[model samples]
Target: MAKYKLPKPGELSSSINYNPPAKDWMDIPVEFKPATYPAAAKEKDLLTVGFPNAHQWTPEDEDWNLPDGWEDTVIKGIEERLSKYRSFKLFMDVCVRCGACADKCHFYIGTGDPKNMPVVRAELLRSVYKRYFTKAGKVLGRLAGARDLDADVLKEWWYYFFQCTECRRCSVFCPYGIDTAELTIMGRELLNLLGLNINWIAGPVAACYSKGNHLGIEPHALKSNIELMIDDIEDITGIRVNPTFNRKGAEILFVTPSGDYMGEPGIYTCMGYLMLFHELGLDYTWSTYASEGGNFGFFTSNDMAKRLNSKIYAEAKRLGVKWILGGECGHMWRVLNQYMDTWNGPADFLEVPVSPITGTRFENAKSTKMVHITEFTADLIKHNKLKLDPTRNDHLRVTFHDSCNPARGMGLFEEPRYVIKSVCNNFFEMPENTIREKTFCCGSGSGLNATENMEERMRGGFPRANAVKYVHDKHGVNMLANICAVDRAAFPALMDYWVPGVGVTGTHELVANALVMTGEKERTTNLRGEDLPGKEGNE
Candidate 1:
């Protein structure tokens, strides 16, 4: 739990100040407050993932207990990455510091911290890059905006890099199109070399590595969780959905974040998936081995991300599933669309995904050989393959939130909206500036959604909550729909803190609510056991 209680909405909102302070950003030292940042990664979690310098340390202590030659390790890690990724070097070199990205970051908008500005955040690393890697920086020193890589600078890197959600909204505004998120990724990678990682990220990475899911749910436990959802489906619809796990020769392999099965609200979304699959008579199987669709390792380092992501393809091949259907998640799709092929490529064993129901080939996913659930559902709705009763969601005045990875990384704008409008009677959009490619992060993304950092999470989520408040007040929106699991887990707290009464849900939960399944008894209550609009008396 957070050490301090969050202020009321009025005081918190009134506390934001966008103005920069009198001193240069470099002159300002980072203060390690208890609740403002996430806790340091535990030694055991670091050891589980084979990270270096496995030892106990707190961010507040002057001694971080870095291993001998830790500075050399970070410098060499930066040099290796500079030599490897062209984008890293290009981003380091190309920023003109025009301040176009200063106001664009949600963290900057909410916290009013100058270092949270994307340009300045990138400069935190670029300063070291300039001092060590560039001739001009080596000659001119501070004159060229270069600073030495010292312990204080490393601490600053740990603080601010973890502060970022890696949402990439800043990259959209940059004239040079510098991806500040990738810069943060690189910064985190360097930090990982010295075993400087947050518990929120490292714990999940370690769990996903050994237990095959972020929650460390064992194979039998994973099956039990789904079976519980199956039982609930029976209770709601009077229809039994028997989903297979680790079954061989299935036509499609279904993968979703473990939260969808294990966590509240996300479990409702999981029920939606089971109901939809049962109605379609689709041939799909779940894998306990590839249980987690989200790759928390992406928040740690690229190598760790690849290590965690390899399980999906491995499971797909072993099961002999013809194609893969992914559930709603933010960074999972980013990894799939952008980095998966490069990291664990070819997916030669699996066939290109074709909707068994609609017969529409997913040409977009031909290479990745995996299709998003919304893309699959939108196609089904397009062909009128499933009967739907939109009024089941009449109780919800719904608005769609575009998860950052899908909107920016994958260009998935209309499919989710199309699905949402088809299922719900009343659908509204947040301000155009706060949606689609320009969407604000849910604030607790990229493993920043830890309980210890409640204040920070609330601060970062303010811009997004403000946008939701607009539609909530104007359009009477009661439910916020999104495709990301992190949004499902993060938004409830955000809404409670910032805009009370706006509930969060996944897209498919609404879909299943509106789905008119074959031979289903009168659904008096929706999946959450809430009464339908006119069926209130019956429930």
Candidate 2:
């Protein structure tokens, strides 16, 4: 008998009865529209920066201009990666299908698509592994839940794999510790072999390869933008802070996502860094060369991730700094904590990162020698080093959105919240399940933040926005602060769409506003130039 029996069309069914579950994997079909894919990687963007494997193609057309024997390329690529990484092999073999991780996926939960289920998404790749590598699948075929690789399977792989954000939320609930992100990266690597990549990912990666930063901002341009920020700092604090660039013998080298220097929420965070460093009189220099802490190639392939990550350590050694201090970012920290030491290590040229201002040593990042900005600020608050007036933020009610990577990948949970609480008296957290280790993605991570996939982003982002709505209604929260660049860039749109009137901001922006700078005029406006709650009509 079929495990699932359908009710007759237009017929009423028992309202309180439980439905049967599917017994066969083949019973489902997966398909997606063109909007589900990222914008096609442009040849000009790739060629301008001379990215390897540069090709001319768009997903709008049927023929992808794939190289000869592309099928052999993907299958062989999988075979090679399986042998190289034992984690891949073990993850491929062990799965009891108890379904603990199935419901944990945001894509599956939001869209209700079966393929978005984490276990099923991994099975798309594992089924092919079974057919080619395992004896049971080779003999039993479909009955053993294995299928032959073909164009249809390849298409399905691209559609579903790109849907994932590599957030690793499912792994937290899995019994066997099966991480779907590992499979997502592997699938992307194999797809890259065929030159199948999204434009938002490939473009930034290519720009970072040649220009030394994403958005292809040049050396003098980075300085110009920074000087503009400095002008703003002087206007507020009556202090003109000047940070060095590529200067050797500095005590520390500060690296953050290139997005920080750009306008909006990120630029304010950059100002926060500048003001805090000036307050402590810290010795540090910025590098126009290793300007970007984020690695978009991480969204593409591991080898590319390593190549981009190498510049940080190389620049540190060149500048003769003690250690590296990274700014507000999500995947940037993930790479630093999980993969930086492994990919490019022996940062023996640098000393351990100890907060000279607070005297706190980051033991978690001792091996990699990188410290997060929030960690540094939290320590200062713990030691009561900063003179802060939390009442400056009395006009706003704040809530925090834990960006997916730092929450799940690294478990760096409490540092940012501690800093926020120390600075703002009116802070509220979202629902318990919607935060911390179980946080939802901004719906546009892993380089899927393209306009073409806005619909998909909206669908995936609904879960997080829905949680924000709950708190906004309950706690009257008008500010939704986070610590990631993508969160700052993407949350504004998500908030506007799902829960209007909720503004997005970086954690440091709040910290900077509440700080009391010495010998400065009495503050009347906060960072965004909004009037201080009760300090209105002041000069």
Candidate 3:
């Protein structure tokens, strides 16, 4: 029952210069005090009396030395590079300081902090940029609250920049469409350049660079995992199927995320891909060479992103595939739809995927002529190509959580919803503002998937869970469905914290679970009418 105040519709502007009186210290709320650092007694009581907890931590050890030449060169380089953009200039010039973006931020809403305002959050980096790069800032010095490089400022940048999930929820309501997400991305990229990346992100980035996949799963491990998933698919569907691996000269290259190969939720979606493709008699190959489509580099640097995406093009070329199907992933689709076509691919050898069943052409499809699995499935259902049992998903009442990357980054709203509705009869929707483009984050997207930020993650998850709680109260939404791997990896933890019984799963899991065996397995009164062999009326 969090009360959220919406911004007055037409009042967004940075230049309005309307300032409220400073807070009266006498009348200040006790809850509004800054969180004090915990004392030694509190820390000792909280600490587990174990071998690891015996070691004392110091402030000097807590803060590391600055990178070589960071202050003189790298920092200035980023400030200069980002300064040249008129878009960045528009962002600086147009934000009306109306605080329209204030309550819209989950971090602010959860913390009730005025400084966590999206505009104020961007100011963390924006202030640095202004001080170093702008004329007004150069002349004014500390008057504009800008300062030169110091360890403290850099540390603050690391903290606040990472606080942003880059969900773009704030940008949706911005009058000038000023994206704080982009600023946060730039801030993170700049910090990453100085070797300031968080452990969780740095580990994955390094793993992606050296090993063709993140999670450090090697090619053989990846193949074995895929094989295991294929076995599970067979166990459930009673269809003995081997999903092709690294098959040269295949007509289509299905590029799923490494997460699907390595983790749950996504792995189920991977199995669904195997079943659907096998049913359609499609010729496709899974390439270990281009094992990952989920790029963390998108949250970091564009250059590093290109380095990551180069694999997709390289693998497609090596396999000689006509098209590559991107699996159910959010950022992967964002990179594929927005940047991959232009960044690292011509994909000249590929053909625009024409539905062989309908003769409809997929045009302007940039890299490897990509098609989202949901879109492909929806089109098949549209053409009366797949025989499905719409009532199979009735056991679980489901609500769709449209991932921000797919919903706003790409206009992929209806396709997934259509696929969901076609496969599951009892599908429900959350509040309108909390779905589609206005959807809140699962609190772990855009690299906040870091294990270190559990408390922050819960705070960020508040808005989405509040929305889900409302939906569950009214419509009994038993499970939350989304396509993003980050969402899958993140929401279960949040559900455990906020609403104990509620569950989260991939969209494809619901579809694949509900898939009719032979499309006529004796339609029952409830859900699980004609599911796989051992799955009927069972968990």
User: If ranked by lDDT, best first, what sequence of candidates would result?
Assistant: 1, 2, 3
lDDT per residue, candidate 3, 491-516, as tens digits?
88898888777887777776666566
Candidate No. with top lDDT: 1
10 residues in a row with least lDDT, candidate 2: 23-32
Off by over 4 Å in 3: 1-62, 83-86, 364-368, 517-539
lDDT of 1 by residue, 1-539 (tens): 66998799999878997765689889999998878899999999999989888899999999988888987998899999999999999999999989999999999999989899998999999999999999989999989999999999999999999999999999999999899999999999999988899998899999999999999999999999889988888998999998999999999999999889778789999999999999999999999999999999999888899999999999999999998999999999999999999899899898889998988999999999999999999999999998999999988999999999999999999999999999998999999999999999999999999999999999999999999999999999989999999999999999999999999999999999999999999999999888988998895
- How many clashes show up in model 1? 0
TM-score of each: 0.96, 0.93, 0.84
By TM-score, highest first, what's the ranking? 1, 2, 3
The alpha-carbon lDDT assigned to residue 537 of candidate 3 equals: 72
Q: lDDT of candidate 2?
A: 0.87
Counting clashing residue pairs in each candidate, in order, gives 0, 0, 4
Across residues 88-167, which tens digit of lDDT does each residue of candidate 2 receive?
99999998888999988888888988788999999999999999889999999987888998767777787788899988
Off by over 4 Å in 2: 1-34, 44-53, 537-539
